[model samples]
Target: GAGVSQSPRYKVAKRGQDVALRCDPISGHVSLFWYQQALGQGPEFLTYFQNEAQLDKSGLPSDRFFAERPEGSVSTLKIQRTQQEDSAVYLCASSTDRGSVADTQYFGPGTRLTVL
Candidate 1:
Protein backbone atom coordinates (compact mmCIF):
# COMPACT_ATOMS: atom_id res chain seq x y z
CA GLY A 1 0.00 0.00 0.00
CA ALA A 2 1.10 3.58 -0.54
CA GLY A 3 0.02 4.55 2.94
CA VAL A 4 -1.40 3.00 6.10
CA SER A 5 -4.89 1.69 5.55
CA GLN A 6 -7.49 0.49 8.06
CA SER A 7 -10.79 -1.23 7.52
CA PRO A 8 -14.30 -0.62 8.83
CA ARG A 9 -13.66 3.00 9.61
CA TYR A 10 -16.57 2.77 12.03
CA LYS A 11 -17.74 -0.19 14.09
CA VAL A 12 -20.59 -0.67 16.54
CA ALA A 13 -20.43 -3.66 18.83
CA LYS A 14 -22.53 -4.99 21.67
CA ARG A 15 -21.02 -4.88 25.12
CA GLY A 16 -19.98 -8.50 25.09
CA GLN A 17 -19.24 -8.95 21.44
CA ASP A 18 -15.85 -9.31 19.87
CA VAL A 19 -14.49 -7.30 16.97
CA ALA A 20 -11.50 -7.37 14.68
CA LEU A 21 -9.87 -4.38 13.08
CA ARG A 22 -7.42 -4.62 10.22
CA CYS A 23 -4.48 -2.54 9.04
CA ASP A 24 -2.35 -2.50 5.90
CA PRO A 25 0.84 -0.53 6.24
CA ILE A 26 2.98 1.09 3.62
CA SER A 27 5.18 -1.10 1.51
CA GLY A 28 8.56 -2.04 2.99
CA HIS A 29 7.87 -0.56 6.38
CA VAL A 30 9.93 -2.29 9.01
CA SER A 31 7.96 -1.27 12.05
CA LEU A 32 4.24 -1.51 12.69
CA PHE A 33 2.35 -0.20 15.70
CA TRP A 34 -1.15 -0.26 17.09
CA TYR A 35 -2.57 2.49 19.23
CA GLN A 36 -5.78 3.29 21.05
CA GLN A 37 -7.13 6.80 21.16
CA ALA A 38 -9.95 7.64 23.48
CA LEU A 39 -12.10 10.60 22.64
CA GLY A 40 -10.45 13.92 23.39
CA GLN A 41 -7.15 12.19 24.19
CA GLY A 42 -3.88 11.53 22.42
CA PRO A 43 -3.19 8.14 20.97
CA GLU A 44 -1.69 5.60 23.37
CA PHE A 45 0.61 2.91 22.08
CA LEU A 46 -0.89 -0.55 22.42
CA THR A 47 1.65 -2.75 20.75
CA TYR A 48 4.62 -2.72 18.37
CA PHE A 49 6.00 -5.19 15.90
CA GLN A 50 9.36 -5.28 14.20
CA ASN A 51 8.87 -7.33 11.06
CA GLU A 52 7.13 -10.52 12.26
CA ALA A 53 8.30 -10.17 15.84
CA GLN A 54 6.02 -8.67 18.43
CA LEU A 55 8.61 -6.64 20.31
CA ASP A 56 6.26 -4.87 22.72
CA LYS A 57 2.75 -5.15 24.06
CA SER A 58 3.02 -3.37 27.37
CA GLY A 59 0.25 -0.89 26.68
CA LEU A 60 -2.57 -3.31 25.98
CA PRO A 61 -5.24 -2.69 28.59
CA SER A 62 -5.99 -6.36 29.28
CA ASP A 63 -5.63 -9.90 28.03
CA ARG A 64 -8.78 -9.45 26.02
CA PHE A 65 -6.81 -7.47 23.49
CA PHE A 66 -4.65 -9.28 20.97
CA ALA A 67 -2.68 -8.13 17.93
CA GLU A 68 -0.68 -9.87 15.27
CA ARG A 69 1.36 -9.04 12.20
CA PRO A 70 1.94 -12.38 10.61
CA GLU A 71 3.70 -11.29 7.40
CA GLY A 72 5.08 -8.04 8.75
CA SER A 73 2.90 -6.07 6.38
CA VAL A 74 -0.68 -6.39 7.47
CA SER A 75 -1.89 -6.53 11.08
CA THR A 76 -5.03 -7.22 13.02
CA LEU A 77 -6.26 -6.17 16.41
CA LYS A 78 -8.93 -8.30 18.02
CA ILE A 79 -10.85 -7.24 21.08
CA GLN A 80 -12.89 -9.82 22.92
CA ARG A 81 -15.92 -9.17 25.10
CA THR A 82 -15.93 -5.53 24.32
CA GLN A 83 -16.80 -3.15 27.12
CA GLN A 84 -18.01 0.43 27.09
CA GLU A 85 -14.62 1.43 28.34
CA ASP A 86 -13.07 -0.23 25.33
CA SER A 87 -14.76 2.09 22.87
CA ALA A 88 -12.16 4.22 21.17
CA VAL A 89 -10.43 4.92 17.89
CA TYR A 90 -7.92 2.24 17.04
CA LEU A 91 -5.03 3.52 14.97
CA CYS A 92 -2.33 1.71 13.03
CA ALA A 93 0.99 3.26 12.12
CA SER A 94 4.16 2.23 10.38
CA SER A 95 7.71 3.44 10.05
CA THR A 96 10.85 2.37 8.28
CA ASP A 97 12.82 2.47 11.52
CA ARG A 98 11.99 -0.06 14.19
CA GLY A 99 11.76 1.19 17.76
CA SER A 100 14.04 4.07 17.08
CA VAL A 101 13.36 7.31 18.92
CA ALA A 102 13.76 9.21 15.67
CA ASP A 103 11.28 7.11 13.74
CA THR A 104 8.46 9.09 12.21
CA GLN A 105 5.29 7.03 12.09
CA TYR A 106 2.64 7.35 9.41
CA PHE A 107 -0.80 6.74 10.88
CA GLY A 108 -3.97 5.37 9.39
CA PRO A 109 -7.28 7.14 9.63
CA GLY A 110 -8.31 4.59 12.27
CA THR A 111 -11.23 2.35 13.12
CA ARG A 112 -13.68 4.01 15.42
CA LEU A 113 -15.20 1.37 17.68
CA THR A 114 -18.30 2.10 19.69
CA VAL A 115 -19.34 -0.39 22.32
CA LEU A 116 -22.85 -0.19 23.64
Candidate 2:
Protein backbone atom coordinates (compact mmCIF):
# COMPACT_ATOMS: atom_id res chain seq x y z
CA GLY A 1 0.00 0.00 0.00
CA ALA A 2 2.58 2.51 -1.05
CA GLY A 3 1.26 6.04 -1.10
CA VAL A 4 2.06 8.53 -3.84
CA SER A 5 5.59 9.87 -3.82
CA GLN A 6 7.45 12.52 -5.82
CA SER A 7 11.12 12.93 -6.63
CA PRO A 8 13.56 15.75 -6.02
CA ARG A 9 11.33 17.14 -3.21
CA TYR A 10 13.07 20.34 -4.33
CA LYS A 11 14.46 21.68 -7.60
CA VAL A 12 16.20 24.83 -8.80
CA ALA A 13 16.18 25.61 -12.49
CA LYS A 14 17.39 28.50 -14.56
CA ARG A 15 14.90 30.29 -16.74
CA GLY A 16 14.47 28.71 -20.18
CA GLN A 17 15.58 25.27 -19.10
CA ASP A 18 13.39 22.21 -18.99
CA VAL A 19 12.77 19.92 -16.05
CA ALA A 20 11.08 16.61 -15.54
CA LEU A 21 9.61 15.49 -12.24
CA ARG A 22 8.47 12.00 -11.38
CA CYS A 23 5.61 10.50 -9.41
CA ASP A 24 4.78 7.02 -8.19
CA PRO A 25 1.17 6.51 -7.23
CA ILE A 26 -0.15 3.92 -4.86
CA SER A 27 -0.42 0.49 -6.39
CA GLY A 28 -3.77 -0.39 -7.99
CA HIS A 29 -5.05 3.17 -7.85
CA VAL A 30 -7.05 4.04 -10.92
CA SER A 31 -6.90 7.84 -10.79
CA LEU A 32 -3.96 10.20 -10.68
CA PHE A 33 -3.75 13.97 -10.67
CA TRP A 34 -1.16 16.70 -10.84
CA TYR A 35 -1.48 20.09 -9.24
CA GLN A 36 0.45 23.28 -8.82
CA GLN A 37 0.50 25.14 -5.55
CA ALA A 38 1.82 28.64 -5.11
CA LEU A 39 2.82 30.27 -1.91
CA GLY A 40 -0.20 31.00 0.29
CA GLN A 41 -2.52 29.43 -2.25
CA GLY A 42 -4.41 26.17 -2.37
CA PRO A 43 -3.38 23.44 -4.78
CA GLU A 44 -4.75 23.98 -8.28
CA PHE A 45 -5.44 21.00 -10.50
CA LEU A 46 -3.18 20.83 -13.53
CA THR A 47 -4.31 17.56 -15.04
CA TYR A 48 -5.86 14.20 -14.24
CA PHE A 49 -5.59 10.73 -15.66
CA GLN A 50 -7.74 7.67 -15.30
CA ASN A 51 -5.60 4.65 -15.93
CA GLU A 52 -3.68 5.50 -19.13
CA ALA A 53 -6.22 8.03 -20.28
CA GLN A 54 -5.80 11.69 -19.54
CA LEU A 55 -9.32 12.62 -18.50
CA ASP A 56 -8.66 16.33 -17.99
CA LYS A 57 -5.88 18.78 -18.61
CA SER A 58 -7.68 22.10 -18.78
CA GLY A 59 -5.68 23.56 -15.94
CA LEU A 60 -2.26 23.21 -17.48
CA PRO A 61 -1.05 26.79 -17.68
CA SER A 62 0.74 26.55 -21.02
CA ASP A 63 1.98 24.29 -23.78
CA ARG A 64 5.26 24.11 -21.96
CA PHE A 65 3.74 21.81 -19.44
CA PHE A 66 3.12 18.18 -20.27
CA ALA A 67 2.22 15.05 -18.32
CA GLU A 68 1.75 11.37 -18.85
CA ARG A 69 0.70 8.22 -17.08
CA PRO A 70 1.40 5.66 -19.74
CA GLU A 71 1.36 2.52 -17.64
CA GLY A 72 -1.71 3.56 -15.71
CA SER A 73 0.46 3.88 -12.65
CA VAL A 74 3.57 6.05 -12.48
CA SER A 75 3.39 9.51 -14.00
CA THR A 76 5.67 12.36 -14.93
CA LEU A 77 5.29 16.10 -15.28
CA LYS A 78 7.59 17.99 -17.56
CA ILE A 79 7.93 21.72 -17.85
CA GLN A 80 9.82 23.36 -20.66
CA ARG A 81 11.26 26.85 -20.98
CA THR A 82 10.95 27.32 -17.28
CA GLN A 83 9.97 30.79 -16.12
CA GLN A 84 10.43 32.44 -12.78
CA GLU A 85 6.66 32.56 -12.63
CA ASP A 86 6.65 28.77 -12.66
CA SER A 87 8.34 28.56 -9.31
CA ALA A 88 5.98 26.65 -7.07
CA VAL A 89 5.23 23.31 -5.54
CA TYR A 90 4.16 20.58 -7.95
CA LEU A 91 2.01 17.97 -6.24
CA CYS A 92 0.76 14.54 -7.25
CA ALA A 93 -2.25 12.70 -5.96
CA SER A 94 -3.96 9.38 -6.48
CA SER A 95 -7.31 7.76 -5.78
CA THR A 96 -9.04 4.45 -6.29
CA ASP A 97 -11.72 5.62 -8.67
CA ARG A 98 -12.34 8.20 -11.39
CA GLY A 99 -14.92 10.89 -12.25
CA SER A 100 -16.32 10.99 -8.77
CA VAL A 101 -16.13 13.92 -6.39
CA ALA A 102 -16.37 11.35 -3.66
CA ASP A 103 -12.91 10.05 -4.45
CA THR A 104 -10.49 11.09 -1.78
CA GLN A 105 -7.10 11.97 -3.25
CA TYR A 106 -3.97 11.38 -1.26
CA PHE A 107 -1.21 13.86 -2.05
CA GLY A 108 2.52 13.58 -2.07
CA PRO A 109 4.85 15.99 -0.30
CA GLY A 110 5.40 17.72 -3.65
CA THR A 111 8.40 18.90 -5.60
CA ARG A 112 9.22 22.51 -4.86
CA LEU A 113 10.50 24.04 -8.09
CA THR A 114 12.34 27.32 -7.89
CA VAL A 115 13.14 28.98 -11.18
CA LEU A 116 15.97 31.48 -11.10
Candidate 3:
Protein backbone atom coordinates (compact mmCIF):
# COMPACT_ATOMS: atom_id res chain seq x y z
CA GLY A 1 0.00 0.00 0.00
CA ALA A 2 1.17 3.50 -0.84
CA GLY A 3 0.38 4.89 2.54
CA VAL A 4 3.03 5.57 5.16
CA SER A 5 6.07 3.36 5.81
CA GLN A 6 8.76 3.39 8.50
CA SER A 7 12.13 1.67 8.66
CA PRO A 8 14.13 -0.01 11.41
CA ARG A 9 10.82 -1.32 12.66
CA TYR A 10 12.50 -2.26 15.92
CA LYS A 11 15.56 -0.93 17.68
CA VAL A 12 17.58 -1.72 20.77
CA ALA A 13 19.96 0.88 22.16
CA LYS A 14 22.05 1.19 25.26
CA ARG A 15 21.71 4.27 27.36
CA GLY A 16 23.45 7.29 25.85
CA GLN A 17 23.30 5.84 22.38
CA ASP A 18 21.77 7.56 19.35
CA VAL A 19 19.17 6.17 16.99
CA ALA A 20 17.55 7.27 13.77
CA LEU A 21 14.15 6.30 12.42
CA ARG A 22 12.86 6.81 8.90
CA CYS A 23 9.53 7.50 7.35
CA ASP A 24 8.25 7.48 3.77
CA PRO A 25 4.88 9.10 3.37
CA ILE A 26 2.44 8.67 0.55
CA SER A 27 3.35 10.55 -2.63
CA GLY A 28 1.86 14.04 -2.85
CA HIS A 29 0.96 14.16 0.80
CA VAL A 30 1.55 17.56 2.29
CA SER A 31 1.31 17.10 6.02
CA LEU A 32 3.76 14.99 8.04
CA PHE A 33 3.72 14.19 11.72
CA TRP A 34 5.79 12.35 14.32
CA TYR A 35 4.56 10.93 17.60
CA GLN A 36 5.87 8.99 20.58
CA GLN A 37 4.11 6.33 22.60
CA ALA A 38 5.17 4.90 25.91
CA LEU A 39 4.15 1.51 27.10
CA GLY A 40 0.37 1.24 27.68
CA GLN A 41 -0.04 4.84 26.65
CA GLY A 42 -1.55 6.61 23.72
CA PRO A 43 0.60 8.30 21.13
CA GLU A 44 1.58 11.87 21.79
CA PHE A 45 2.36 14.36 19.08
CA LEU A 46 6.04 15.18 18.71
CA THR A 47 6.24 17.47 15.72
CA TYR A 48 4.75 18.31 12.38
CA PHE A 49 5.80 19.59 8.98
CA GLN A 50 4.10 21.16 6.05
CA ASN A 51 6.08 20.24 2.99
CA GLU A 52 9.70 20.92 3.88
CA ALA A 53 9.01 23.43 6.60
CA GLN A 54 8.72 22.40 10.24
CA LEU A 55 5.61 24.05 11.60
CA ASP A 56 5.43 22.71 15.12
CA LYS A 57 7.79 20.99 17.52
CA SER A 58 6.14 21.77 20.83
CA GLY A 59 5.63 18.14 21.62
CA LEU A 60 9.22 17.01 21.46
CA PRO A 61 10.27 15.74 24.88
CA SER A 62 13.57 17.61 24.87
CA ASP A 63 16.27 19.17 22.76
CA ARG A 64 17.78 15.75 22.22
CA PHE A 65 14.92 14.75 19.96
CA PHE A 66 15.00 16.06 16.40
CA ALA A 67 13.11 15.51 13.19
CA GLU A 68 13.39 16.75 9.62
CA ARG A 69 11.70 16.39 6.28
CA PRO A 70 14.40 17.56 3.91
CA GLU A 71 12.51 17.01 0.64
CA GLY A 72 8.98 16.74 2.01
CA SER A 73 8.63 13.12 0.93
CA VAL A 74 10.89 11.24 3.31
CA SER A 75 11.49 12.24 6.90
CA THR A 76 13.73 11.14 9.75
CA LEU A 77 13.56 11.32 13.51
CA LYS A 78 16.65 11.19 15.65
CA ILE A 79 17.02 10.59 19.34
CA GLN A 80 20.34 11.37 20.99
CA ARG A 81 21.59 10.29 24.41
CA THR A 82 18.96 7.66 24.57
CA GLN A 83 17.44 7.07 27.98
CA GLN A 84 15.14 4.43 29.36
CA GLU A 85 12.42 7.04 29.47
CA ASP A 86 12.87 7.51 25.73
CA SER A 87 11.93 3.93 25.03
CA ALA A 88 8.73 3.98 23.02
CA VAL A 89 7.19 3.51 19.64
CA TYR A 90 7.80 6.27 17.14
CA LEU A 91 4.92 6.72 14.77
CA CYS A 92 4.85 8.70 11.55
CA ALA A 93 1.77 9.90 9.77
CA SER A 94 0.79 11.88 6.69
CA SER A 95 -2.32 13.59 5.55
CA THR A 96 -3.25 14.50 2.03
CA ASP A 97 -4.46 17.77 3.42
CA ARG A 98 -4.01 19.86 6.54
CA GLY A 99 -6.00 22.40 8.57
CA SER A 100 -9.33 20.79 7.94
CA VAL A 101 -11.13 19.33 10.92
CA ALA A 102 -12.13 16.42 8.76
CA ASP A 103 -8.76 15.66 7.28
CA THR A 104 -7.61 12.11 7.95
CA GLN A 105 -4.09 11.17 9.01
CA TYR A 106 -2.67 7.93 7.69
CA PHE A 107 -0.16 6.26 10.01
CA GLY A 108 2.84 4.04 9.48
CA PRO A 109 3.34 0.79 11.33
CA GLY A 110 5.79 2.50 13.66
CA THR A 111 9.32 1.91 14.94
CA ARG A 112 9.71 0.67 18.47
CA LEU A 113 12.79 1.75 20.37
CA THR A 114 13.98 0.07 23.51
CA VAL A 115 16.69 1.71 25.56
CA LEU A 116 18.55 -0.11 28.27
lDDT agreement of model 1 with the native: 0.95
Q: Whole-model lDDT, candidate 3? A: 0.94
Could you give the candidate ranking by lDDT, starting with the highest? 2, 1, 3
Candidates 1 and 3, the one with greater lDDT: 1
Model 3, runs deviating above 4 Å: none
Candidate 2 lDDT over residue span 1-116, tens digit each:
67789998999999999999999999888999999999999999999999999989999999999999988989999999999999999999999996567999999999999999
Candidate 2 weakest ten by summed lDDT: 94-103
Candidate 2 C-alpha error for residue 78, in Å: 0.3
Q: Which of 2 and 3 is ahead in lDDT? A: 2
Over the stretch 1-116, how does candidate 3's per-residue lDDT look in tens digits? Answer: 57799999999999999999999998999999999988899999999999999999999999999999998889999999999999999999999875576678999999999999
Candidate 1, 8-116: lDDT as tens digits: 8999999999999999999999999999999999999999999999999999999999999998889999999999999999999999986468899999999999999
Q: Which stretches of model 2 miss by more than 4 angstroms?
A: 98-101
Q: What are the models' TM-scores? A: 0.95, 0.96, 0.95
Model 3: per-residue Cα lDDT at residue 82: 96
